[model samples]
Target: MSSIARRAAAAAATGLTGAVALAVTLTGVPSALGATTGTASLGALRASTEVAVAAHGVNKEGYEGDEAPAGVDVHQEVSTAQLVEAADSVQDPAATGTSGTRTGIGCSGDGTSGNRVQAVYVGVAGQNDRYDAVVGALRAYTAGVDGVYLASAMEHGGRRQIRWVHDSSCQVVVDHVVLNPSDVASFGAERSALVAKGYDRGDRKYLLYTDAAVLCGVANVFTDTSPLQSNANNGGYAQYARVDAPCWAPQDHSVEAHELTHTLGAVLSFAPHATANGHCTDESDVMCYVDGSGVVMTQSCPTTHEKLLDCGGDDYFNTNPAPGSALATNWNAANSSFLFDPPAPTATLSYDGSAAVLAPSVPSGQGWRVDWTAPGCTPATATTTSPGGARLAVSCPSGGTVTATLTQQDGRTAQASTAASASGTPAPASSAAPTPTPGATANPGPSVAPTAPATTPVATLALGLTTVTPKTVAGTRVVLTGTATTGTAPAAGTRVALQRKQGTGWTTLGWARTSAQGTVSLTVAPVATTAYRLAAGTTTSAALTVTVTPKVQVSASGLTVKGAVRPAAKGTRVALVQHGRAVATTRTDAAGRFVLTAPRSGSGYAVTVAAQPIAQLALSAR
Candidate 1:
């Protein structure tokens, strides 16, 4: 029968299932074939011709068709054992059946039950070699699912049987070149052969014809049983599964996952229905059809392949409740509770000048309150001052136990305590005892008198120097002031030296003596960067380093600017001056080159490069 006629007939018997109803349809095929084929005597010849025509239209229909002649004697039955053996040949080596003691292959014990999954392979009986790769990929990908069984039939078993394979633990079944070689027109020929067999039309099951013409894989899940009459009717391949044109990168696992998802979507009727020119591009879903053809083809569904599968969303995608719809929504909802992981408890103690305090804060999402208590002190309730900040204050007697308690928003509390003591005071300096002095004798005539040697006052002094500015220009004058004190006031001429710290010692720059006020100032020439220290008597102050940045002067010379017109070119030369002396010079080459040097100490200077004259052209400065 013609592809169209077979599809129309299938549509007419939509939703019919079971052996009782199938038997009635099988008995009517011969009569119908007689009318459609025209010559009853040449039934075999007519059947062969019909198969050829249908196989040619297989691509047009988007699936491989059965190529058997209508009345030609062909094997229709195969033993269950033979089917199992055939399937095992194509089975994935990794797939294993459930055995309680079989370490990783058995069902997990975490409430998923001991569902056994088996793998069986069905070999290809057709001309397409791609089926081998496709089947292999399916086996390797679905090895983790429960119970996979492979089966094969001498004749096509149709869409209902295909749906059964997907719905059951049977991971996949492969069929080789079922299309007629002579009939290479539309793919509808393949669909026709399946419809001729007692295939179920109620559950829209589709076949993907991944041939040379369509290098990309194809997927179809029909909501309605009249597979041929659906939008898949056009030459575009309707009742049609989605088709991905062949791509060079067969490693594109996302494409395979996407097609498989469509199959799963079909069984669940979860994918959006094809609409508007037999295409659905609206909505940010993987199921949405994309526009364009060839290698650069775009898809209507949101490309979650990278985010969902590549990231950690594969499990969610595999068990998507909505199937063909947006998988992201369901995935996010399932993992909402695990979005943010709470951080562990962390406590930090810091001193604000004189007080030692402990501040504890938890993550914002975790509602925790902090309370503080101390021995011989008042306990304070913890309060949340900010989204993530909790404040707890406690007053304790000197040398007491301080405890901090953390209460979670869920009403669970934990406490941590530490023993602490008040800081001690510094001891006072001791006073020196009075010293006794010798006295002269009384009642003596013309006696020799003795006098004690003149006492010398101890000269004790201290010096300190500070840098008012951290950075300065070369040759900039810097002030160094020093204050000196003595045990009995300085002799008014004690010298204090301002020195710079060298490699391992101090080098005195200059020296000054203390006045009656015991203070002195020293002025020194600033050359290179230096660190200064003040020395007086036996005391030396901390070192203070001051960095002296050089002053630079950059200038442009021999600048010639034509007019701002066509072919207008300008040339300029530049020279660098430092400390009242020319240091470097350079000329412009096509563009402009300038010389840069450090200037003498005085504020700072900058040179500008202009496109036109100084007043009219754009200017750039350095």
Candidate 2:
């Protein structure tokens, strides 16, 4: 089917409110807290990475007389070591400090990064598997085909402190709060009622990760609809979504990523501004609207073009991009905007006679191997999956020095040496270079070639000119239209500003939030030939100069005037003066140009351009 036809049919099927009612996945059964917050400094760096809040205009309730507000019920957040910095994983936790402004969000729980947080996860009837669905989808979106964690960067709006870890190593500590019918009553049906009833049970909430948590339910989420639909310009302190087709039930992580990013900020009614809605125009994004048909819509299928339930299964561009927008790409396509740099592995090494052990801190998905160089000593060459931590056994002289080489997932390597004594004399100083701070990239291969991808530049948002009403202007005002995508069509209600270059800086003339296909048309009139551009979020389109032609005609006669100009004009008087004495005066025609013929030339003459004086127009009839 044509992309347009498919989109139209999908819209007909679910009638999702493009912005608020985008279908998501998940299904949870009330489960217990499996792992406690452990002080496992196991590669846990103590650096304080800054987290910014994007939810600007949440619907805070004032129901002291009744139930709590929309996002009042606070959940416990899992405090796994928050990712601040990592030079290929092993990092100095104290090197960085927390940054970014924190707005008061209902779920900004405990004020401390929980050592662990939970939400009311609801999904398909009879199935108690919301947690797994979320986790799997989370894995699918955050950890892509290579298994590197890429979603957390969304929290800081593409600033920094992003890193990757093994699927086993980067495992998040999460718990769940089972959602029931009474719980979702607020979400599934009418909108504000969800808030009213939700305030009543404000007591139910679940786990918090480093990022803002979302309340997963199975109902439609928009309450006010129309004028409210115009709210892409605002943000919510917390997000409450209802997954339809409850088929993926609560398992659809793509939708989860979509709603979750709204709290962080993206594809708003206006780009770069966290106003109103939180969805992109791109259907591939987790935030785009979709026809709730099948269950699995996120994973990349082997078939080319074929997708599961309209989901943009290409996990590459999972999140939408805008000005300050963020996304995950292969390390090869990474630029300064991506959170994680091209990875270089870091690890610790030790050895015993006949055995050498090496542990590496990889940013997930990297395969690692350890090697040994000592008389009679050989270490295991097979790679230990990142989570497993590479370990090798070798036969070495007891009194001789044994060196262990650790290979990283990206082909970079680090090595250390330890001298062993039969009597155990302090094990001869061990030497494995300290890991660099996160964001500090390096390559140290252990006798092997690098496996890291080639360094290719990438962008946060892809914006370009698609259409304009008057291809060539015959007048001043022209209608210009265009498209912007993080990689897909933006959600409805998001803003796209029409900007004009004024002298040195660009100023906003007006905005056109976008239609379903991620396009916006705005009629703008520039007084003269002026330059124009489009701004959405932090992304701006290339400057599109709209050529404006002004009609300014000058003629000379006795007390007469004639002229023409476009768009029409703001009034200005045209004085016909001979020397310093006025002979005749008339207002410029409504079109901006004017004519004034003096009855007599008594002295010097001076006629000039609107703003700049024209010396050539001075008549020499002294």
Task: Find the candidate with the highest lDDT and give its number.
Answer: 2
- What are the per-residue Cα lDDT tens digits for candidate 1 across 245-363? 12111221223333433333221222133331112233322223322132122333333222122122222222223334343322211222101122233343322111223443332
Q: Which window of 10 residues has the lowest lDDT sum in candidate 2?
A: 5-14
Name the regions of candidate 2 deviating beyond 4 angstroms.
1-111, 114-175, 178-180, 185-236, 241-253, 269-346, 359-376, 379-382, 397-415, 420-622
lDDT of 1: 0.30
lDDT (10s digit) by residue, model 2, range 129-154:
22432332233222221221232222
The true-versus-predicted C-alpha distance at residue 184 of model 2, in Å, is: 1.8
How far residue 616's Cα lies from its native spot in candidate 2, in Å, is 99
lDDT of 2: 0.33
* RMSD to true structure for each model, in Å: 33.7, 25.4
